[model samples]
Target: METKQTDIKLKTPIRCIVKLGGAAITCKNEFEKINEANLITVSSQLREAMMFGSSSGSVLEMDWSKRPGMAESLVKVDDYKEQLVLDFSSFVVIHGAGSFGHFQASTSGVHRGGLNQPLVKAGFVATRISVTSLNLEIVRALAREGIPSVAMSPFSCGWSTRERNIASADVSAVVEALDSGFVPVLHGDAVLDEALGCTILSGDVIISHLAAHLKPQFVVFLTDVFGVYDRPPAEPNAVLLREIAVREDGSWSVVNPTLEDSDKQVEISVASHDTTGGMVTKISEAAMIAKHGIDVYIVKAATEHSLTALSGKLRDKIPDDWLGTVIRHVS
Candidate 1:
C-alpha cells in the first residue's frame, strides 16, 4: 500500500531507516530463490555497521573471516569491549518481497485485489506464505547477529489501503518495539484494502510513511544497482545521479548532472514481473522522504561502498569515492 501509516512517537529518535531491496537479496529471475550470498553479505554488513560503525570489526571470532562485507577482510575483535561505540539505536528495517512473493502475487494478480476470485484468494495466501517465509529468514539472520530484532508484519498490524494507497495504519507495535530498544523489522506484504479487497504493499511506500512521521536522521535503500540513474543502469546511455534534490512542489533537480525533472518522473525501468512498481516506486518514495529534509541514500548491495553507507558513519556527506545517490532538499 502507498500512504498513511500514521503513528510512531519519537523515543530514542531513529538514527535511520533501512530498506532492503529484494533484488539485492534474492535472484529475481528464479522463483522463490534467495541469493544466499547477498543476503548473508547484507546481514553481516548490517551487523558490522551497526556494531562497529565505519571502521570494520566483528563481534565473532570464528565467523569473522566468513562474514559478508567482512568477506575478504578477516576481522576479529578479540574482545567485545574493545569495539567502538556506534549509535545504531532506534532504527527500523524494511525489506521488499523480492523473489519470495512477487511471482506468486503477480501470477495471481493479487496486487489488484479481488479475493473473491479463487485464483486471487489462493494467490493471496501463497503470497503471504512466501513473503512471511522470507521475513523469518531475515529476522533469523539478524537474530544470529544478536541484534534484538523483532518481526512486525504490516498486514497483521492493521495496515489497510484504498486503491493500493495506504488509507490508514496502526503502527503502535512498531513504536512500542522501538521504545523497548528492539529493532522492529517490517516487510512489504499483502494488505486489506478499501477500494480493492486487498493489495500489495511495497517497502518503499512503508519507509516513506515512516520517514514522514519519525523524521529519522537519514534513510538508506540497499539495492542491486549502484544508485539512481538518469535511466535504467542497464541502458548504454544511463548516467548515475550522485545527488538529487526533491523540491517542495514534488519536482526534483539533479545536483551532479545539473538536470531537472518537472514531471516527477524519471526514465527508470520497472521489472515486468514486479507486483509493486520497481525502481520508479523507490525513487518516488525516496523523493517523498527527501522533501521533509531527511536525506536518503541509495547504494548497491554486497560492495564496500554499501558497507560504508550502511555503517552510518558518514552522516553529513557522501564522500567522492562513494558509489551511491543521495536524495535530499537542495534548499
Candidate 2:
C-alpha cells in the first residue's frame, strides 16, 4: 500500500475589525432613520483604507463579476472590472442598529434583559427584523463602494448568557468569509439566551467577542463624536482624551487627565430610544477587549480620512497625536 501525503493551507490573517457605531452612522434619536450620507462617506473612506494596504504587496481583490444577480445589480460590468484589479484589506465590519432596532427594543422592553412578558417576546421578533433591515442597507452601501460585504447576524451565530451578555459565538463563518476575500458585515441583534428567553446583543459586545476569537491587529470604533472625553461633550468644561492606557494589572488611566470631573453615567447616555447601554458600556467592553492585547481605537466617522488614519494608512496625513481615543495595554 502506498501512503499519501496531505497538504495543509495557511489561513489569511484579518488585519482589522471595524465597528460602525449606531450614533455615528444613523440618526439614533429618529425612528428607523439611516444617515445615507454618513453611510456612503464612511464606506468610501474604508475603501481607501483597505486599498492602502495593497501597497504592501498583499493584493486581495474582489471579483465583482461573480456577484449573484449580476443583471439585476446596479453595478456596471466595466466598473466591476475596474474594482477587480484593486487590492483590498482583510477585515470584518460590525455595525450597530442605531435607530432601527433601538426604537423597537426600547418599546418592547427587550434591553432590560430576559423575557417573560408577552410584549417583550413580541419585541424580540420585531427587533430582529429591524436590525436585519439595517444590516441589508449597510451591506448595500459597502457593495456600492466596490467592497464585497456579506451581511451576517449575531442571532444566527451567537448565544448569550443568563445575564444577556454574549457567552459564546461561532465565528467560523466570519473567519471563512475573510479567508475567501469577503468582508463579513455583522450588527447588534436579538439573540436567544440560555438564561434569558432572549436579549439584545449590542454591536460593541459583539466586537469584544470577535476580538477574543479573531484576534485582529486592530479594533476600530467609528463613533459620532471625535472620541472619549473627560466629560460629556455637552458639559461646559469637557475635554477630549486622545489616549486611554490600560495596565496589565487591570488598572486604567487617561493620558491627559482632566481636572473637571463629572458623573460617569451622566457622561455616557444612551439615546432616548436606545435600549443598549451607550458610551459607558462601550468603554467597559473596550476595556475588556483591550485586556486581550489588541489595540482599540474610537474615532469619528465624519472626520476627514478618519477611517484611513485608523487603518494605519494615513499616519503621515495626521499629526503624531491622532484625533481619536486609543485603548492599549501598558508595557
Candidate 3:
C-alpha cells in the first residue's frame, strides 16, 4: 500500500479576520441606505491586502488561465511559491447591519423574540431581508474588485442561539470555503433561538466568535470613527482610546489615555433605533476575545492607517502616529 500526502489548507497561517462595522459602511441615519463610497473604497483596500500571502506551510496555489472556451489553449502552472497570491483566502470578512435591519428589528421587537406575537414573527422575516440584501451588495462590491467571495449568513448556515447567546453554531462550511480559495463573507443576522423563537445576532458578537474559532494572527475592525472612544464618537468630549489590555479575569482597562485624559469618560450609549447593544457591546465582546491572547485593532475605514491595517501591517506593534485602538491580553 502506498500513502500519498494530501493534506494542505487553501492558505495556511491565516493573517487576519476583518470586520466592517455597520456605521463604517452604511448610512446609519438613513434606512436601508449603503455608503457606496465607503464600501467600494474598502473593497479595493481588501483586494490589495489579500494579494500577498505565504504559500502555506505547504504549497497552496493552483494557478490556471483560459481564454473563454479555448480548452486546448489553456495554460496551467504551479509556481512553487514561498510567497503567493493567496492571502485573500486567508481573510474572513464579517459585517454588521447599520440602517439596514436595525430599524425593522427594533420597530418590530425582533431581537426581543416573541414567537407568540404576529408582529415579532413578521419582523424576523423583514429583518433578514434587509440584512441579507446588504450582504449580497457587499459580495457584489468585493466581486467587482476581483475578489472571489460568497455570502454566508448565520441564519441559513445552521446558526442558532439560546436566550440571545450563541448555543449551537457551525463553522465547517466556513473552513471548507476558506480552504477552497474563496473568501467567505458573513454578516450579523436574525437567528432562531430555543428560548426566544428568534433574535438578532449582531456582527460584534459574530466577529468575536470568529476570532475564538479561527485564531487569526490579529483582528481588525473598520469603523466610522477613529477608534474606541470614551463616549459616543460624536460626543464633544469623546477621546479615542489608543490601547486597552484585557486581564486574565476577562476584565479590561485603558492602557493609554493617562490621568490627564480624565475629562474623557468610558460611558457608552446604545442608539435609539439599534436592536443590537451598540459600542458598549462591541467593547465588551472585544475584551472577551482579547483575553484569549488574540489582539484586536479598531481603526477608521478608508484612511491611510486603515489601508495599512487591512494590509496586515499592523499585526504587531501599531505605529504611535496611527489613530486606532488595540486590545491585547496582558499577563
Candidate 4:
C-alpha cells in the first residue's frame, strides 16, 4: 500500500530578484537587436547560479575570438549542471528595454510624463511593441535553458502618477507566478498613468516596489559597467565603490562625493535614446531598497560572472576583483 504523495507540502524557498540592464543584455547603440551571444552567456549564468549551491561549481571562461563584444576576456561559469544538488527556491527577473523601448520613450517624452500629442501617442505604441519583443526573447531564452520563465507586462497590472512615479500596482499575478514555481520575467514598459495619459515605468523603479512587497533576500542589478564608480569608469582616475551602506535613519553614505554641493550622487552616462535616468537613477533606487533592510548588488554582467558571485556560490569571491558592488542597511 502506497501513501498519498499529495499530502506532502514544500516550504517556501528563499526569494531573489535580478535585473538585467538593457545595455548589459542588448547593444544600446543598436536598434531593436539583442546581443545574442551575451544573452546566452548571461542566461546561462543565471541557470548555473541557481543550479549549483557552492564554490565548487564551474567557472565561465571567456573566449574573445568568438565575439567582438565579449572579446579579450575569460570568465568562469559553473560546469556542474548535471551534478548540482541544489535548486533556486524562487527568482524574479526584470530587464530594461535598452534601445528597444528607450528609442520610442525618449522621442515621445513618455518618461517625462504622458502622451499628450498624437505623435507621442504613436511613439507609445511603438515603444510597447519594441519592449515586448525583447521581453519575449528573454523568456524564450530562459525557457530553452529549462527554467520555467513567464513573461509579465507591467502595462497590464501597473499604475503610475502624473509626476511619472509608480503609485500602485497589482502585482498579484507576479506573486502568483512565483508561488507556482515560475520565474516571472518583467520588463520596463509604458503603462497607463492616473494623471498623465501614459508614462514609461522603469525597471529599476519596478524592482524596488517588488522588493518592498516580496522582501527578497537579495536583489542584483546586472549592468554594463563595474558597479558604482567614484566617477564614470571611462575617466582616467575613476574608481569602483565596493559597497554603499544605509544608516539607521535610512540615509546612505555617498561614495566619494566629488560634486561641489557634496551630493553623494555619482555621474553616470545614458545612451542617447535612454529616457530613464540611467546610472544615477539605478544607484538611487538600489539605495532605497537597501534602506528597507534588503541587500542589493550592482555588478557588470556582460563580461563577468558577477551573477554567480551574488548567488553566493563562491565563499571567497572578492567584490572588487569580481567587479561587483554591495548595497546594504545597518543599524
Give the alpha-carbon lDDT of every model: 0.82, 0.75, 0.82, 0.74
Pairs that clash in candidate 2: none
Candidate 4 residue runs with Cα over 4 Å from true position: 1-14, 52-87, 114-116, 254-263, 313-320
Model 2: number of clashes?
0
Per-residue CA lDDT of model 4 for 149-258, tens digit only, reads: 88899886555544577766766777678767778999999987777778888899989877876777788899888788877899998767776677866667654323
Across 127-208, the per-residue lDDT of candidate 2 in tens digits comes to 9999999998888788767688899887776555456755667676777787788889999988877766777888988898
Candidate 3 clashes between residue pairs 3 or more apart in a chain or in different chains: none
Best TM-score goes to which candidate?
A: 1
Kindly indicate the candidate among 2 and 3 with the higher TM-score.
3
Ranking by TM-score: 1, 3, 2, 4
As for candidate 1, its clashing pairs are 1-201, 2-166, 3-166
- Candidate 3 lDDT over 78-137, as tens digits, reads 333333444454899999999899999999999999978999999999999999999988
Question: Which segments of model 2 are wrong by more than 4 Å?
Answer: 1-10, 52-75, 78-85, 113-116, 257-266, 313-321
Better of 2 and 4 by lDDT: 2
TM-score of 4: 0.81
TM-score of each: 0.86, 0.84, 0.85, 0.81
Error of 1 at 19 (Å): 0.5
